[model samples]
Target: MVRPRLTIYVCQESQHGRDPQHEHEDGDSSTGTFFVYHAVYLEELTAAELTEKLAQLFRVPAQQIQQIYKQGPTGIHVLVSDEMIQNFQDESCFVLDTMKAESNDSYHIILK
Candidate 1:
């Protein structure tokens, strides 16, 4: 069976001391500094595991990840925690839909 693939656009900016909530409140658009990644997986992953994968891909520390957001029809949806990712998968069928549609929709990973 072919593994499911996800395309993510990870923001290169470090959150550091910035407020994660307010990062996008001012309506700032994408900086075009993202490191695009195509992640293929056969099994569902926890947020920490996802973070570890991203850290390896980006060569950054996992702890530097402050949050992860998925772009949705309504708005950006947060998936920074295990519970949140699980709830998102359950409610929105994110992984299934991505697998079916082969959508290249970006998942934003905010670094600290």
Candidate 2:
């Protein structure tokens, strides 16, 4: 059977403090710097959904999938099969850093 394709975009909060503009003028200090990751993408799935997808895609146990998320935001983790890595590597995937964006449609989309 043909498997459904998955692509993931990961971003982690920076260890450094929040940006001065986001804290002073915006009056939002809770948000810190977030860095987008370019590699190791997964199919955009939620907690429960991803668990199931990982099981079906990789034929692994539930505990393994849970462990991936527990890895924390410091690094990106994906529980995918060995065969999928090569196949999906060429696809275009991205993680948008929209914290500083003002409007919903402000971001640009480029199709290649």
Candidate 3:
């Protein structure tokens, strides 16, 4: 049987808060560094599970993720929820906003 798969682009929020006006002016609404993720699902996945996967990918605690947004037209960010994931599509892009104010370069590395 074929398994479900998705190709997603994940971006870390910039240290500076997003400015819609500036993004529009610059004409590059999606300007941040994005990491491509190819996810394959053998079974159904939940929002919490997805969060954990993202946490692992970014090397940060899952709790640090404050919000997850689906990038819309012109860089509009739409809040992602369980309901949203129910209808999630392949090749969608998302931006991760963490609780900390530091840049993504400052992500802690925990040695296990």
True lDDT of residue 13, candidate 3: 36
Runs in model 1 deviating more than 4 A are: 1-37, 42-44, 83-112
TM-score-superior candidate, 2 or 3:
3
Clashing pairs in 2: 7-42, 8-41, 8-42
Candidate 2: tens digits of C-alpha lDDT, residues 4-63: 355544433344586666554413356654453433334433445544543454455554
Cα deviation at 93, candidate 2, in Å, is: 5.1
TM-score of each: 0.40, 0.25, 0.47
lDDT of 1 by residue, 1-112 (tens): 6554333333333224444454554223344221222443413547766667766766666666555656556654544666644543321222211111133333345322
lDDT of 2: 0.39
Off by over 4 Å in 2: 1-11, 20-30, 36-78, 89-112
Q: Per-residue CA lDDT of candidate 3, range 16-75, in tens?
A: 445545553423455632233345341344566666677777667886665556656666
Give candidate 1's TM-score. Answer: 0.40
lDDT of 3 at 11: 52
What's the lDDT of the predicted structure labeled candidate 1? 0.44
Which pairs clash inside model 1?
none
Against the true structure, candidate 3 reaches a TM-score of: 0.47
Error of 3 at 29 (Å): 19
> Which pairs clash (backbone N, Cα, C closer than 3 Å) in model 3?
none
